[model samples]
Target: MSSAGRVPQGLRRVYLNVRPERLGVLIGEGGKTLRDLENRTQTIVSVDSLNSSVVIEAATPETPIEMVLRASDFIKAIDAGFSPERALRLLDEDMVLIIINLKEVIGDSQSHLYRVKARVIGEEGKVRTNIEQLTGTYISVYDDLVAIIGDYEGAYLAREAIEMLIQGREHSTVYRFLNKKVRELKRKRLTEYWKKDFSTKEVKS
Candidate 1:
């Protein structure tokens, strides 16, 4: 849905579409979720269920578009198969959403795409679960899309692992790579934290 001429003068609005089946999830039980989102963002979310459309309008003319965008992202995460609680994590500034389109990688071959998707999912969702646990990310395989929500580094790492699966790498190989890289990342973060702490202590001394 386009907001080009629909928005009133001096008002900021964002338009987005949720999957028809996910619209109720976006709205929440008895509108509780939608109300919470508006309360937090200082925006009004208008849902057009018939069209699977959502329009987020600033409560006042002074509201920021950033807030609107954030709300949009939250809705999108839900549409991509995240529960509201998981999608709410995007409210944190460091969190992000990354989507991988399987059709693009597998070149319109449904059988190839199915195989790749299976590789990412593994038997009983073990592969997907492993990547999420190791990387601290949420992975959702819906249709031909893989959606991930996490901090930037975690999301990127998850994306890489999925891509490797698509490229026909052995699952064991991917798991090993993830384990090594996650350790490296932890070490790097620890080093940075200690350096910052040392600097603070030096200043105090």
Candidate 2:
């Protein structure tokens, strides 16, 4: 975040493990996604399809770890079932990713996981959409996992909202909770805005 567009010259040889199937997403079609990421982050991102690992290396051993890690997070998001486009949002300093493991809550029953996933998904994706709309996040319900992408507050709020649904909480109750969270987030943002404005004025005075 603090690094913004700056690429440091000391970060090197960081590796992250990803699913082999996900390598396609990380590399993108025809390697377009891979090329785009390398260009944007100024680093070399190598995907080993056989081993299901990604190496984020400095193009010149000078690329900063922060940038590499940022790239790593983006790829992780994709591996977690987020689309590559949505994964890119992690490039923003304030963006956060939260993954909820259905297995942890519901145990090893495949039927239970499927049922719980549907519950979070709602009758026709309505529940998922509502949660995303209210929290301003992207939600992915896939293979016993619930993945969310949003700013700090939105991601966690969405995660809890989804978890409640999986936990058998009433839909209406979860909606209400999300509504309160939205209001709280907006108020906090406004407060921060005013504080920043006031600080600027103080400096001028």
**TM-score for predicted model 1 compared with the true structure:** 0.89
Write the residue-wise lDDT of candidate 2 on 173-197 in tens digits: 9999999889988999999999999
TM-score of each: 0.89, 0.87
Best by lDDT: 1
lDDT tens digits by residue: candidate 1, 1-205: 4444333555477788788999999989999999999988778999999999999888866556667767888988888888999988888889999888788878898888788889999999999999999999999998778999999999999999999998999999999999999999999999999999999999999
**TM-score of model number 2:** 0.87
Whole-model lDDT per candidate: 0.88, 0.84
